[model samples]
Target: MTNEKKKNTITWIALVLLTILSWKFSESLSGKMGLMVVILASITKFFGVSLQFLELKKAHSFWKFGLLGFLVIFYFLVFLFFS
Candidate 1:
């Protein structure tokens, strides 16, 4: 297999593992802690999908930074709204 395919496979596996981990954490942790953990995992998965599948890794720095900044505000708002 090609390197790109290998990377995608690894990323997919990682995302799956993270989802399972977050689910487990939700069952075991308190409300605030579980929310934080799940949100962190979601952010990670978002970046992975954006950079790899969406081809954002090759995007110009401005676009990349813009997405990052946008997500920061969005996630912060989400956390505030839920917490």
Candidate 2:
């Protein structure tokens, strides 16, 4: 397959693995620790989606950084507020 297709496939696989891991963590851990793990996994999945599916990897640095920054800041704030 082409490089772009390969990259997308890899990203998809990573997202799937991360989803499973988060689910397992949720089941194994309770309270704050589980929330933290799930949030971290979600942030990682968001980046993978942005880069692979949204084609943000080829976009300008400002847009790329801006999107990721927004995700991190928002998630962090939520994590802080809740925990």
Candidate 3:
């Protein structure tokens, strides 16, 4: 496979693993770890969606970066809410 395809596959695999691990250990894990996992998963999902959209539309850099920033802030808010 091409390098880009390989990278995307790996990223998807990692996202799935993180999602499962976060769910599995959420109750037993420390609060901080749980929060971190949730944040990471959220960020991963956000980037995955944003990149896919950008690729499809050949979107401008500003929009991609703006979406990323929004995702980061959204994750922060989610963490705070859970905490």
lDDT of 2: 0.95
Whose lDDT is greatest here? 2
* lDDT at position 64, candidate 2: 100
Residue-level lDDT for 8 in candidate 3 = 73
Per-residue CA lDDT of candidate 2, range 1-83, in tens? 99999999999999999999999998998889988999999999999999889999999999999999999999999999888
- Deviation in angstroms for 68 in model 3? 0.8
TM-score of each: 0.88, 0.90, 0.71
Model 3 ranges with Cα > 4 A deviation: 52-58
> What are the candidates' C-alpha RMSDs?
1.3, 1.2, 2.7
TM-score, cand. 3: 0.71
Instruction: State the C-alpha lDDT per candidate.
Output: 0.89, 0.95, 0.72
Flag the better candidate by TM-score, 1 or 2: 2
Report how far off residue 50 is in candidate 1 (Å).
Answer: 0.4
Task: Report the poorest 10 consecutive residues by lDDT, candidate 1.
Answer: 26-35
- Badly placed stretches (over 4 Å) of model 2 are none
Error of 3 at 43 (Å): 1.3
lDDT of 1 by residue, 1-83 (tens): 99999989999999899989988998998778888998899899988888887889999989888997799788889989999
